[model samples]
Structure formats: C-alpha cells, structure tokens
Target chain A: MAFLKLESLRKAYGEFVAVKECSLSIGEGEFVCLLGPSGCGKTTTLQMIAGFVEPTEGRIILNGADITRLGPSKRGLGIVFQSYALFPHMTVAANVAFGLEMRAIAKRERRERVAHMLDLVRLDGFADRYPRQLSGGQRQRVALARALVIEPSVLLLDEPMGALDALLREEMQIELRALQKRLGITTIMVTHDQVEAMSLADRVVLLNNGSVEQVAEPFAMYEHPSGRFASTFLGKSNVLAGDVSGASVLVGDQELPADLAGMSGAVDYIIRPEKITFAAAGGLVRGQVTARVFLGDRWLYQLDTPVGPMQVIDTNVGLPKAVEGDAVGLVWAAENARVVARGAAS
Target chain B: MSRTPIALHIFHWLFVLFMVAPLAVVVLVSFTDKGYISFPFDGASLRWFQAIWNQKSFIDSFWLSLALGATAATLAVVLAVPAAMAIAWHRFPARDLALALLMSPLMLPAIVLGIAILRLLSHLGMTGSLAGLVAAHMVVVLPYVLRLVIAAAAGYDHALSQAARSLGASAWAAFRRIELPQLVPGIAGGWIIAFVTSFDELTMSIFVSSAGTTTLPVRMYNYIANTIDPLLAAISTVLIALTLVLMIVLDRLFGLDRILGGKA
Candidate 1:
C-alpha cells in the first residue's frame, strides 16, 4: 500500500456530483499535482483529503489509518490556502505558535519551536511583526512555517502561488519546490497552470468535470496523453482525425506514416507541434502557413494541412523565416503521433 | 497653494458653526445666573450645577440610567457578536432578510417600539421592572451593535479560520485565537454606541418607567413640563459632556472613523 490513498472518493450535492469515483495512491515523499481547469473538482478533492470537506462516499487512507471521517484539526494535514490566511491580529510568532499553544506545549518550548520554524522560513527578524506588515511573499513564507511547525503528515496546497505577482509567482515556484524537496514531505498541490504542474510534480493527475481523465508522470502525460482533452489541455497538440487501415492510418486521402500497433477503426490522435520538422521535397505531407506567431525562443505556424488545421513550432535559432501564405513540407517521426480516446468535457 | 474655492471654504466653516452653535448655547446657558434659558447673560454662576448635584431624585435617577445603559449595552453585545458572526461569515438563504429583521428596530419609530414593548411587558405583568427597562433598551441599541460588528466582520478573511483548523486548532479554538482579537474594535465601538443610545433614550422610558424605576430622561422630561430652569440646561450639559467623554474613549480605543467604516 502507498503512504496515502484516496479510495474511490465521491462527493455530490443533491442532484449534482462534484467529484465522481476518484481514486489515487501516493508514495512517501512524492510530490503530486492535481492539474485541471476551473470546476474540475481538484480543490474539492484536496479539501476532502484535508478533512475540511467530507467525502460523501470513500475512504482517505493515510499511513494505513482510515481518516476519512476525521475532523480537519484531527487529521493533522498542513494546508496552505491561496489567500495565505495568516491571522491579522497576531504577530508572526503568535500566528506560528497557535497550533503548539493549542497542544498545551509549555511556553518556553513553544517559543523555541516558533523561533526555529521562523528561521527555517528565513524570517528570523520578523517574529514581532504582524501579518499586515509583511510583503506578499514573506506572508506566504510565514503561512508555510505556521503549517509546517506542527509537522503534519501531508502538505496540501490550493493554488499556493496564485496570489503573487507574475514575477514573484515564478520566483516562489522555484523557492517552494526547493523547500518541498529539502523537507521530502508528502505534498499534493492543486493548480490549473500546466507549466507549474509539470515543473513541480512527480506525477500530475488531470481532472475533467467530476472525474479523473488521466494520471501519469508529468512528461509522460504530456508526451502520450490518454484522451483528447489531456492532449490539448496540457499543451498545444494538432489532433488528426484518421481511420486506421491495415498497417497505416488514412487521413484525408493522405496516408501519413504512423505506428499502427493495436489501435484500429476510427481514431483521433495528437502530434506535438514541436515534433514536426521541415521535410524535403515530396515530404510526408504538404501545408500552407495560414497564421504565424513569434515567441522569444520559438516561432509558431498555423498551417492548413490536408488532414485539417495543424500547428507546427520551430526553434528560432537562425530564425526559420516561415511567412504567411508560404507553402511548406512537414514530416514527423512515425511513433511521435499518439492516439487518444475521445472524451466529453462534462 | 492656489487658494481653495472661496464658496467651498465658506460652506465648510458655516457647516462647522451650524453644528457647534446648539451645543455652545447649552453650555453657556448652564453657567448663567438667571435660572432660565440665558444666552449673553450679564453674569454667570455654577449655582445650577450645585442645585443638580444636591437634588436627590436627579442624582438617584442618574445612577439608575447609568446602570440600565451599561446592562442593556452588555446584553446587546452578548447577543449581537455571535449573530453578526453568523450573518457576516456565512451565506444562507434569506441572509439579507434575516439581517434586515435583526435591524428592523432601527427603522421603526421610537414611540412605536415603546408602545409595543409596553403592551408586551404589561401582558406579562413585568412592566416597570428594571429587567423590563433593560429589555426595552436592548431593542434600541441592538441595531448599532449589529451594524458596527457586521462591518468589522466584513473585512475579515474567513480563510483564517480554515488555516487555524488545519494547524490543529479546534473550531472553538480557531475562533478564540484568530477571530476574537480582530473583532475587538467593532465590539468596543458597538458597546459604546449602544451605551450612549440607551442613555439618551426617552420615548420608551416614559411608557415603561414607574416612580421607582424612573430613568434620568423620564425625570428630566417630567421636570421640564412645569419649570423653565438652568438645572435642565445643567443636566443637558452633563449629558453632552458624558457623550464627548465616551466618544473620546472610543477614539482612543478604536478610532471613531473606523466605527463609521472609514480607513483610519
């Protein structure tokens, strides 16, 4: 058994289901991200595991203990809310000391632990300042220290860096990841940002509506998405509608090379835009550039291909100089295009 | 400094003087020797203050009113704090309607509230009791407590409670440690405002007070029905001074501007 397991969790309110039959197993000291768009029940799942929201049907097992029915305070999971939720009235030391104080730790011991935790978060000199006196990033560090002071079993983050400015958010992402790695804590973060998820998680569980869509290693999920939504939502992908025929797939009268293993019948698949390269004359396919965008590191071209509208991205080293209305030859590795199942948004 | 508009400057001072003139006349008349309403008098004395201080009925009723105001304001705080917490912190069906009902007394005429309380108390045969007076006074002051505390709670980030709970504090502990401290300013403001409201209330006291339970406001009204005396002016001056002291206390504690929802 894993260190933490969500066994077939389900939550519903009257006629509407918020999370349906969601199950996951997390190993010790592994970082996982619940990645999805809004209303995907990611936050709800994290809340249920934290014991803030009770699961209507399922068990949350932590270290072989059935804690699904426990209260949040009893579950002893550290949660960093998006708001950073530091108490305004209490100084930094008091806010961090509250949990220790609640456990009836002696005043001297509580003070020592608070100072140690503050130093851990690099806030040694801010012990006497109120939360309102700290900057956004400092306040977040205080919130982190407050949660970590209790030595909780799991650290749950609900869009932990959502409130910071863009530059500060990026900086905190690196700092937070470093801190999480150093602690080796069993951590789960909920985020809609694919980059943040891919950069932080050992595994990303993609959710759609009230159900799990795909869960895999971040790169594996991106490289070989299990469904159309995962393929498109995780990163840009050109989905080609094709019918598998014998050893090849037929795509709009053009039988592009493909690895036709067990997949058969009508299929929809994704080819990553960066995987496609400029082919020689009489290439695997022909396309005309309909639109183009210049990113700092790469150039994106929206091409009108025989299969459908396709996107191709090429690095800007020496600048590809692909212009609109230019005809281009495109080819990709046969195994690079991955077949995925069609799934509904709902 | 490009001189602010002359018309705007004139309006500002005129507004200030308009507000100050009534209170100024009361203080000046309270010092007069004429024993009646006196402004620009030939001579002045503190004889009326001495007269008010020596009068046993006024002195006794003054203490009665003080105790009633404090008791009623305390009760209102006890009732309003939790109610304001519930109303401000959670979203339920008809929440606005519930708040409106809680504050309906503020919209009702004082005479109406007085008569209604009188009828209810008389039916229960508890009329003219100190408890009845405190109960009537609670109705007059509850709205202030609700409005002030609700405004304070409005600025609160409820996620603080969740963070507290996650950090191993029980629900009660979370509220005690995280919420109560932040709410002190509003509670103090509410108590002071309610105390002043109850101290100045007269319409309900007239209907409820018997001779034994007569409040200072009722005694002053009864006294004024026959005599024109500086004793009345002296009493009014004392009440005004008491209100100023309370305002100063509130300013020192929570800043009066914050009670009115200003960024102090």
Candidate 2:
C-alpha cells in the first residue's frame, strides 16, 4: 500500500477552486515534487497535505488512516517554509528543542537531540547564536534541522530554496536532496521552478489551473508529455501545428511521416529543440535559417519552413556554419516527435 | 544652496526660542535659592528640592502615580496583545466596527471620559477608590497598547506561523513561540507609552481624584494653584527628569522611533 494517499482532494475558497478533485498516492520514502506556475494550485495541494489547509472535499489517507479532519498539530508532519521561519528570539539550540519540548521529551534527551540536530545541520558550535546572526543559507539549514529533529512521518517543503540566490539555490537543492535521501523520509515539495523539480524529485506532478496536467518521472515528463501544457512546462520545446494523414502529417505544403500513432485531424506535435539537426543532402524538410543565436556551447537557429518557424539547437562542433538567410535542410528522426491532441492545449 | 535669508533665520531662531524658553525658565526657577520663582539669572541652590522632599503628600502622590501607571500599563498590554492578534489574524463579523469602538477612547476628550467614568462610578458607589482610578486610567491607556500591538501583529510574517503549525505546533503554541516573540518590541513600546500617558495625565485626574487618592498631576496642579514657590519648580524638574528617564528606558527596550511612529 502507498504510504500516503490523497483521494479526490478538493480545496476551494468561496466560489474559486484552488485545487480540483486531485488524487495522488505516494509510496514510502518517495520524494515527489508538485511543480507548476504561480496560482497553479501546487502550493494549495501541498498545504492540504500538510493539514494547514482544510480541503473542501475528499479524503486524506496516510498509512491507511483517514486524517482529513485532523488538525495540523495532530498530524505528524514536518514542514520547511520558503522564508526559513526560524524563531528570531530563540537560540539555535532552543529552536531545535521546541518540537521535543512539545512532545514532552526528557530534558537530557531534548538537549542531546538538539545538539545532534545542530551537528546534523553543521551548526554545532552556533547553537547559542540567535537566528538573526546567521546567513540566509545557515538560517535555512537551521529551519531544516528544526523540522527534521521532530522525526515526523512525512516531510513537506514549500518552495524551500526560493529565497536563496541562484548559486546558493542550486547548492541547497543538491544538499536538500542528499539529506532527504540519507533520512529516507517520505518527502513532498511544492516548487514553480521546473529545473529544481527535475533535479530533486523522483516524480514530478505538473499542475495547471487547479488540475493535474501530468504526473511522471522527470525524463518521461520531459520526453513524452501527455499535453501541450505539460510538454511546454517541463522543458523547452518547438511546437508545430499539423494535420495527420494515415502515418504521415501534412504541414502546410510539406508532408512528413508521423512519429506516433492516434494523432487525428488537427494536432500539436512537440519536438525538443536539440532533436533537430542540419542536413546538407536528403532530409525531411528544406528550410532557410532566419536567425542564429550563439549560446556559448550551442547555437540556437530559427528556421523558416513551409509549416512555420522551427527552432533547432546545435552544438558548435565545427560543422559548416549556417548564417542568417542561408538555405538549410532541417531533419529529425521519425521517433523524435510526440503528437498531442489539440484539445489538450489549454 | 544660497545663504538663508536674514528674515528666515530670525524666524527659525524665534521658533527655537519659543520652544525652549519655557523649559529654560522652568530649569532656572527650579534652582532659585529665593522663596519664590524668578527667571533669567537666579541665585541657584538646592533649598527648594529640600523643601519639596520635606512634604510627605508629594512623595505619596508620586509613588501612587507610579504604581497606578505601572499597573494600568501592564493591564492594558495583557488585554491588548490577544485582541490585536485576533484582529490581525481572523476576520470575524463586525471586526472593523469592534476595532473602531475600542479605539474611540483615543479620539474622545480625556475630561469627558473622566467625567463620564466619575458619574458611572458614583452610581455604582465605587467613586474615590484606587480600583476606580486604575480602571479609569486603563480606559485612556488601552488605545495606545492596542494600536502598537496591532501594528506588530500586522507586521508579523504569517508564513512563519503557518510553518510552525505545519511543523507540529498547535495553534496556541505556534502563536506563543513564533508570533508572540516577534511582537515583544511593540508590546513593550505600547506599555511604555501607556505608562507615560497615565503618569503625566492632569485633566482626567482633576475630575476623578478625591482628597487622598489625588495623583501627582492633580497634586502638582493644586500646589501650583496655591503657591508660585520654587518647591513647585523642583517638583516640575523631577517630573521632567522622570519623563526623560522613562523615555531613555523605552528607547533601550524598544527603539524610540518604533514607539512613537508604530514602526517595528
């Protein structure tokens, strides 16, 4: 059985729905990320799971027990916030000892546990220091230590690295993932950043407008998105509109073999930018390079074709360079494209 | 910038002199060795200070004011913090109306409130009592405490409380651990201002004080009415010194800017 199951969980504020009938089952020790843009209900769903928000409908089953109506305190869950909400007046040791104090642990044990938590977060000597004295990253670590010290059943992180700078954010993402792995805690994170989701989550749940668009492993979500929103949101893609004819697709005046089955009259075909290559001789479609942008390791070229403008990414590998307004042939393997139904665009 | 105009300079000096001249006169008269008040150059002595110390009534009234002010300020804070938190966090029906009602005392004239309380206390047969005075003072001081605490609560990061709740803290525990500590500066500031307001209050005390229950301000007013002695000057000097000390203490506890302007 899955460790945590959210069955048709719905959260609404007045007439506005923040999260629709969403159901997800996460196995024990799985690190899942709810990834979406702002107002996409990822945070709302996370809050519902954390018990900070009461879902308007549906049940929350954790370890086969219904906890839908349980208060946040009664539900044993640890949460790290975006702002790293460490108690400003308390010392690092006192802040870490708070959870144990609430649990009514013995003084000596609480002291030892606090010390151990401080050491775990690599702030052993800074136990007596106030939170204001610590840097953003150190404060974040303190928050992590404070939450993890509680030894709760599930861990929830809401945009945990959102407040850090770019370099520090990336560093903390790696550190957080490593820490979660070491602890083997069932973790769920809500993040709008796709890169962070891809780097940390075992599975990413893509949400759009209060509904789940797709839920899959990072690679699968990126390579084979079920909808336009999912494909575009997971990573960069070149989307082209076309009509399918048997095993081929008609794009304006050019007819190309369809990569996948079940594509109907009108469909949106998604191809990763990196998949398209420049061909000199025989190719699927002939086009002219309209624009070229050098992006350090690679060159991003926009090709004007019979269908539309197709974006292609190429590594700067000493190939005969294609300049702007230069005639070029664009080609990709038949298996590189994934056709999604047009109705799923929204 | 060009040199300030001569007329503007004179006006600036006039304004400064207007502000400082009365205080300067009080200080000079306080040190006068003569039996009565005088201005400018005075033969300075500690004789008036000794005379003021000789009176037991002034000393008793001073302590009484201090005790009442302290008690009222403490009571105000105890009442205001939770009210402020409730006002900040939840939106109950008529919340704004309730806030406006609680704050109405601030806009009302102090003498009117004092007279109204006196009439009510007389009806209840509780007039001329210490409890009555403290209760009346609480009414006046409550708005300041509530205003500061509300500002503090409003300024608090709601996410912090949510984070605490999500981390297994009960609602009360989360507020006690996360929200309350952050509000300490504002609460302290509110307490100080309330104490000072009650301590220096004169108009309200005039209407409410009985013979033995007269506060320092009422006693001071009566003393000044009867005699223009340097003894009164000495008392005024002491009050000024007390106010300065209280302000310094408040500044140390919670920055003066925060207390005066409701900025945390």
Candidate 3:
C-alpha cells in the first residue's frame, strides 16, 4: 500500500500553472526525489506535499487519511529548509527540543530525546552553541536533528545540501541516506542537481514545465528517459535528429540500427556520452575529435560527426584513447540508444 | 587602507567641534556661580544643581515624562510589531498605502500635527488628559518603531516559521518561540529609539500638554522663557548625562552600529 499519495494535484496562480496535475504514490519508507531545473515545478510539488502551498485542485492523502485541507502545523511532517532555518537565538539543544516542546512532551523526555538526537547527528558536545557559531555542515546536522527529533511520519528536505561545499555535500548525502534508512522514515527531497538526486534518492521523478516527465529508479530513468526533456535534463545526451525507416534511423545518410517498433517519421536518437566507444574503423558513425577535456577520472572528447556534434566520455585508465583532430568512429549498442518522438518537448 | 588627508581630518574635527560646542557650553555654564546665563564661569559651584531639587515642578515633570515616554513607547511597539508583520509578510490590497498612512506622521511637520491634534483633543474633551498626551506621543514615535521592525521583518527568513510549523508547532507557538526571539534586536532597538524620541519631543508636547501633564522638555522650555539662569543649564547637563547612559546601554545590549546599520 502507498504510504502517501498526491492525487492529480494542480496549482495555478492565475494563468500560470505551477504544478499541472502531477500525481504520484510513494511507498512506505521510500526515498523519492523531485528532480528538475529551476522553475520546473519540482519545488512547488515539494511545497504542496509539505502543506506549505495549498493545491488549487486535488487531494493529498497521507497514511490512508485525506490530509488535503490540513494546515502545515498539523501535517506532522519534519522539514529541513534549504537555508537550514535553525533558530539563531536558541541553543542547539533548544532548537532540537522545540518540536517535542510543541508536542507538549514532558521536560525529562524532551531532554533525553534531544540528547539522543544530538548524538545521532554527531553534535553531542556542541548542544549549547548557537546556530551562528557553528560551521555550515554542523548547522545542517543541527537542522536535520531538529527535524528528526519529532519522530515525524515523513521528512521533507528542500535542497538540503545546496548550501554545503562539494565535499561536505557528498559526506552529508551519505550520512542523510543512512539516517533515513536506519529510521525507516519516508523521505522526499527536492533538488536541481541530477547527480545529487541520482546518488541519494531511491526513485527520481523528473519534472518539466509543471508536469512529471518520468518517474523511475535513478538508473532506469537515466538509461531510458521517456522524452526529449528528460533525456537532456538528467544528463548530457548526444541527440541526433533522424528519419525512422525500416528498423533503422537515417542521420545525414548514415544509417544506425534502432528499435522503432514500426513507428515512422522524425525521431531523436539519444545516446549517453559514456555509452559510445571509440573505434579505429567500421563503427556506426565516423567523427573527428574537435576538443578533449581531462576530468581527472575521465576524458570528455568533443567530436564533429556526420549527424552533428557529439560528446564521448572515455574512462581514464592510462592514456587518452584519442586526441584532438584525430579521426575515429563512434560505436554503441542499439539497445543503449533511446529513440524519442521529435517535436514533443525540445 | 588609505590615510585621511590632513585638510579633510581638520575639516571633520571642525564639524565635530561645531556640533559639540553648544552642549559643552551648557555643561560649563551649569557650574557657574553667577545667577545669569553668563559664559566663561566666575567660579565653579554646585548650588544650581542643588536648586533643581528645590524646584518641585521640574522633578514632577521629569517623573511624568519618564512615565509618559515608557508608556507611549510600549504602546507604539505593541501596535507596530503586528502592523509591520502584516506589511512585511502579506500581500493584501493597499499594503503600500497602509504603510504610507501609518508612516505619514514622519513626513508632516510636527507643529502642524500638534495643532491638528490639539484641535481634535479639545473636541473630544481629552486636551489636558494623560491619555491624550500618550496618544499623541505614540503617533510621533510609532513610525520610527515601525520602520525598524519592518526592515527586520523583511530581512527575516520566513522559511524558519514554516520549518517550525512543519515540526508540529502551532502558528502562535511558532511566532512566540521562533519569530519573536529572532526579532529581539529590532524590537529592543525600536523600543529604545521610540522612548528617546518621545522623551526629547518638544513641539507636539507643547501644544498637547496641560499643567498637570507637563513633560520635562516643556517644563525646561517654560523655565527658559521666564528666567535665563544657570539652573536651566544644570538640568540640560543632567539630561545629557542620562542620554549618554542610555546610549551606552543600547550599544551594550545590541550593537548600535548593527542596529542603526539596519542588519536586524
């Protein structure tokens, strides 16, 4: 059974539709991420679920109860804002104890629970410090502890790691994921960073123009994006416009094998950079390397091909397989390429 | 860092001296033994300071002014906090107009406001009442309080309130525990500013005050009009000291630089 359900939710501010009939059912203890670029309604959808923004139409059911009209205070959900939003005037212990205090929990239990939460977040000895005195990562941990202390049914995080540096963000991501799983709490996080979503979430919901484009496991969504927007937004893709005919896509007179399933007309042949391999000869498409960028663990090669410009990523084991101005053929399995209908969402 | 030029530094000192000269002269004249307002003291004496204790009206007015300023400032802050929150947090129709109307007293000339308020109070039979005086002072000090509170509220992280609410805090609880505590610097600064402004106000108090409800500044003004003596200078010196103490207190509690620089 679904633990939470957003049923045909739509939010419109006059003529502008912020979230257009987005629907999803999340399983118990599921970690879902609403992933998209800015203004893609990902944040709006998260806000609706958090009960901060009321939907113009539709219902939100939580734990088999219709909570569509419930106010945020009664939602019983934990939330960590992008800015952390830790109470600057309160000590770390007091900040975490706030939720329990609001619930009218007794003083001794509040203290014990708050202490335990501080330990859980590894902020045990820093309980008396104020938010301003703590570093960025420490403050984030305080926010997380504060939210989780209430033992809420679901935890909502809005760009939780956006404020942290890259290294700290990665560290926090692992810690947050472990904490969520250990607690077995349902989690919904909103992020524009695809890498963060891919690494952190159990399921990634790709949204565009106020609608869900695709919702699948991170690997599945990345491997088989449903449309043009999903294919490009999640990661870089070398999309070649081609004509579909006889189980093949013809790009600038260069035929490439594809699974069109008898569908005809214009289509976009999408292939990830890492999936394409360099060949000396007899490959799908012949291309000349235009530029090569060394990315520590990988070498990203830009190439000019018969169809259009293509990007290919070769793993950095020893030396680069190809250099700038080198002529090479690019090869990829037909199953690895995604054939999306053209002109739907470019 | 670049050094300030000697010419500019001299000009700055001259400007400071120009501002402090009159106050220094008042302090110096307060110690004079002469009966009149003569500059360059004959000899130092504390008799004029002793004379302030003999004047019952000055003492009474001083206490009355303290009560009036404290009461008026508290009332202004109580009203302004909610008013500022509404203006800063909501998008109601006429929000800007409401702010303008509330802050309109700052734009109007004080003497004009005094006359207008005097006319209205007399009609309401509250012309000489303490309530009327406090009402008038609240009008004068509310804008200062509201401006600071609004700035603080504007800079406030609204997400904090939402976070509190989502963590099972009721709206009132969130406001009381989270929002109000964060706004302490603004509220404290506004209250202090309002108190000082109301205490030092002269023009509006002159028109609105009765003999029974006279303020310290009005009493001082009346004494100056009747007799130009060193006793007046002594009272001014005492006020300067009190004001200096209040400034120190304000700075210690909430850094004056930060509050005045509008960071809160």
For model 3, how does the per-residue alpha-carbon lDDT over B1-264 read when each residue is reduced to its tens digit? 999999999999999999999999999999999888888866889999999999999999999999999999999989999999999999999999999999999999999999999999999999899999999999999999998888888889999999889888888998899888777667777887899899999999999999899999999998889888899999999999998997798789777887665565
Q: lDDT of model 2 at residue B124? A: 89
Runs of candidate 3 with Cα error greater than 4 angstroms are: A344-346, B259-264
**What clash count goes with each model?**
0, 0, 0
C-alpha lDDT values of all predictions: 0.88, 0.87, 0.92
Each candidate's DockQ score against the native complex?
0.82, 0.69, 0.89
How much lDDT does candidate 2 score?
0.87
Candidate 2's displacement at residue A102, Å, is 1.2
List model 2 lDDT by residue over A56-82, tens digit each: 999999999999999888888988988
Instruction: Kindly report which residue stretches of model 2 are placed more than 4 angstroms away from their true locations once superposed.
Output: B1-19, B248-264
Candidate 2, residue A167: Cα displacement in angstroms equals 1.9
The worst-scoring run of ten residues by lDDT in candidate 2 chain B lies at B35-44
Residue A153 lDDT, candidate 2, scale 0-100:
90
The CA lDDT at B41 in model 3 is 65
Give the Cα error of residue B227 in candidate 2, in Å: 2.8
- On DockQ, the stronger of 1 and 3 is 3
Compose the digit string of candidate 2's lDDT tens values, residues B45-82. Answer: 98888888799999999999999999999999999999
Cα deviation of A276 in candidate 2 (Å)?
0.6
